[model samples]
Target: MTTTSPHPSRTTSPPHLEVTWTDPVTGRKGYVVIDRLVRGVASGGLRMREGCTLDEVRGLAAGMTRKEALHYDPGNRYIPLGGAKGGIDCSPHDPAADAVLGRFLEAVGALLKHHWTTGEDLGLRQDTLDRVLAGLGVESSVEAVYPLLEDPAGARRRLADAFAVDVDGIPLPDLVGGLGVAESALTALDRLGIPRTSARAVVQGFGSMGGATARYLARAGVRVVALVDALGVVANPDGLDVEELLRTRDALGGIDRSRLRPGDTEADGDTWLDVECEVLVPAAVSYCVHPRDQARITARVIAEAANMPVLPEAEAALHARGVLVLPDFVANSATNAWWWWTLFGDIGADATEAERKVRDAMRRLTSDMLVRAENLGITPREAALVVVDRRLAAIEERFGGPGAHAAARREGSRP
Candidate 1:
């Protein structure tokens, strides 16, 4: 279904620019939402999926803006990037998907020149990205292929070999993002006086971020008790075996049903919310935790691995219920990954070292942020916004005092 009207109550100010394009060849539609730009530059992911709507893209773009803006450095120094997101309302299974993506890219080529950079998201893949870029002959026009494309090192080598051009380090968005989320959850638990070793957790997705998050949390001494995906929700009171689940899970986040244990049972989607656990991780989609869903949440903490997984009203309800919510932008960890890669460079030559570096960075950042929020007696979401506003103010000072930035973000000015 098309979104004829935008969500009037956005988490942030309206985006600076919203451009919609219709592919003349396939009659498909695409959109690029630029929430705001830090000195005429912004970056986020590109998601291609059936039923993807403009408002969803707008929300994701705004989340990216907050994620980028929330980078906290000791010296008040960090790479400042604005938030942007692109999406095409189409299925990945369509035979003409490549052509549609190519056409959509071409239509938005002008805006992508240097203003907004995009990476990969939910329904998009690396091979599809390569095909689209090859068709457009605009390889340099792209930025990073993040959450959707994990093997940055291999992708970099392949591109350099094909074009004989130097390629820099490619950031592993999912791995680092997952690591960060796991770290944030543990930090939240610590702040709440919950013992890490005895904490139980339930994850709401089993794809890239969800699966990785489960594994990391398990390793950190948290019992991953349940997992939910498109197929169905599976629960194991004794705690699910994450490693075996990973081995048996399909690319679509479905389990082979045949591999289920006799005690394992399939349940409805909200089964996770009803599971008695100390930590609840919404790692799949936006608006999963609505007002009605709050009554089912038994967990003391909700660490958002997905962007905007909890609606604003739901968050308020969660707060009223004495639940500590680690906001999406803060918990997702993509922000930390971006900050580390852009500032510190490569952590080590191997994956183990890379994970260690991610864990360290996330632990420090999450710990400090959570403690500060607790001391201030404010929600983590409010604390995060304060941090974002501070950074944006710094950018304004550096950019010769913000001119029309305020005007461009007005709702009536969006186009």
Candidate 2:
């Protein structure tokens, strides 16, 4: 892994803790950033990519904080946890990826035991991580929060059942995030008075989030015109066979060209932004959209399925160009919320119930953000920050700030 330094810019409010570990055998670097802690644990996922940096992990951790706080509902049984994130500066496709991940987990075993709860992210999968954790004698990725559960055994059973669920041949956990993204895109279109059937979408990733987003959008009468994977762009002006492509995609989001349909046109990966469409989803990597790439984006709405996919300046540019960006924390929040809702007994492991709850929550949240944006004459990201800040303050006021709980726990633990 590269030893590239983190970006100079830092979050206004510094994270509670940030740790960097270097694997002795592979020399690969891994990072963990706990942005905040609500109660006693924080939640996020671990991602692996060749150029992952501490700064990138920091931004994602902060985003998780907002994502958690945004879903704070007083009536719900599930309370939002704090935000944290882990990242490895190595490609997930590398042969030593699994070994490096295991070593990294072992290095951070103490944090996993008490403070940070994590799961899959960008270049990692849940099953792979679960196998790694099991080897380390860790019961679950989220075992840090077991102390807070009223029924730890029951909660674990519920989460396991939820993970066992399959919706349309895809696991329920994989689809919920994309379902949220799809609902957000659809909600934005409806608010703009555009008929769903007339909308064309170009998705920039073919992984779990993008695949499910394309699937749901296509099912809802939207034309999925193109899908951009690691290799190149698979496009069709009349709409491609999303299901066929989805079936042929590899774990790393590379599409199998041999399975392409007759009408599908393959193009250079760089031309993904050139494909004309009403909706564009950047579900692949962070900082993919810069100001230079902003001019070529024809989509009226960009739903973020990947964390921090758009650069700040580029988002500002897009807002100036009248492009509504459904911010990542708001758009892709359903997966995190769904896990807690199911584990906390707010909902069951049933697919239909999960869909209904996720759809309803995303619709309401997206609508609120858009309305606030319109009323305040601000960008959706700004509107969402406003909502997040308000909710976070309320939560802190009710349960005390993150530090208070940590201090109380420490005090109680000591003789």
**Top TM-score prediction, candidate number:** 2
TM-score versus the correct structure, for each prediction: 0.82, 0.95
Off by over 4 Å in 1: 1-13, 72-78, 140-173, 339-349, 401-415
For candidate 2, report its TM-score. Answer: 0.95
Number of backbone clashes in candidate 2: 0
Model 2 scores worst on lDDT over the 10 consecutive residues at: 1-10
Candidate 1: clashing pairs of residues? none
Question: Model 2, 1-415: lDDT tens per residue?
Answer: 2212122112237788999999999888999999888877899999999988898898888888889999999888788888899999999889999999999999999999999999999999999999999999998999887776778799899999999998767788988999999999999999888899999999999899999999999999999999999888999999988887777788777888999878889999999999999999999888889889999999999999988888878888999999999999999999999999998889988999999999999999999999999999989988888888888888778677655786534443121
Instruction: Give Cα distance to truth, residue 17, candidate 2, Å.
Output: 0.4
Where model 2 places Cα greater than 4 Å from the true spot, the runs are 1-12, 406-415
